[model samples]
Target: MLNLLSNLICTALLSAPVVSEPANPKALPFEVSAYVTSENKIRVAVEKSAPESVVVLLRNSKNEILFQEMISKKELKYAAKLDMKNLTDGAYELEFKSAQGAIRKQVNVATKPVAEPARVILMNTPAE
Candidate 1:
């Protein structure tokens, strides 16, 4: 019975699906990616190297910083969102700075405000 169980385990391990890595791996210690997660809000993802803190900076085409923030990193995979309301639509850059290095990505802000769904609530009053 023990031998049979060992063989079954080995077969299962051999049959398991394997996940392939990227053909071209990133040479940078860390990677930062940005996308429009919501209307007027761009979501940024930080992955790869571990970091303590990161500086989030929004810059215009002229390389002038329009907004900035220092965020503390708690986990290896960290995410941040930037509000793009009341800003003109055009090319922009989102820069994330850390001890390892900084990564910048170009993003265009043309997202419209997301429509919020309606909500209803019922209230009950007690006798005075």
Candidate 2:
């Protein structure tokens, strides 16, 4: 009886389910950088570990798409330029899409009122 009970206890312990922790999701292996030039153009740079074709889109605050473009190349570096001069002065979004996924970053383009040029004055002075 003692041996049978020990065997039963050992079997119960061995048959117990093992608890495991969940695994975290993998992150995207790419980096996105954006810049606004002095000429009111938005330039987005896409850098990735592998070569891929990227699709870029610009949208307004209301989620309406303003411009879209696709770039295909063998290299990992690419740039997308968007003209913001025609767009209204407000907040905007630049979205980068590729085989991995899509990433968005906010961009603000504000325009100041144009100022008129001032008159130039030329004075002639005699050297002592």
Candidate 3:
């Protein structure tokens, strides 16, 4: 019975349609995200449609604005970066608003600084 089941499964899988081509996703109207560094440096990215006025703001957990900037889109696309340092480690939000739309992204700066991790552990490793 196990052999029959395995043969049937293999047949069905081989007959299944193949999705070899991947569809490209459309970009959002606006986006706001932050890239935090372990050295306590935060780089904020704001992307939006061209020919629109965009307001970028960084606020603390208490909704107090820490940084604010206004950008006028005079090209086909617009992107802005904010280098934030010397800020106390805490939760914050980066906001991008315009006549088109608004996007908010959270920024978590735990007391223990952290950035992207690229290392992985294998199960075969000996227990320390």
Q: Which one is best on TM-score?
A: 2
What are the lDDT scores of the predictions, listed in order? Answer: 0.59, 0.61, 0.54
Alpha-carbon runs more than 4 Å astray in model 2: 1-26, 73-75, 115-128
Candidate 3 lDDT score at position 92: 71
Question: Can you rank all candidates by lDDT, best first?
Answer: 2, 1, 3
Single out the weakest 10-residue window by summed lDDT for candidate 1.
11-20
TM-score of each: 0.52, 0.59, 0.54
Writing each residue's lDDT as its tens digit, candidate 1 over 18-81 gives: 1122322353445666666324466777775654677778888888999887766666677776
Error of 1 at 15 (Å): 39
TM-score of 1: 0.52
Give the total clashing residue pairs for model 2: 0
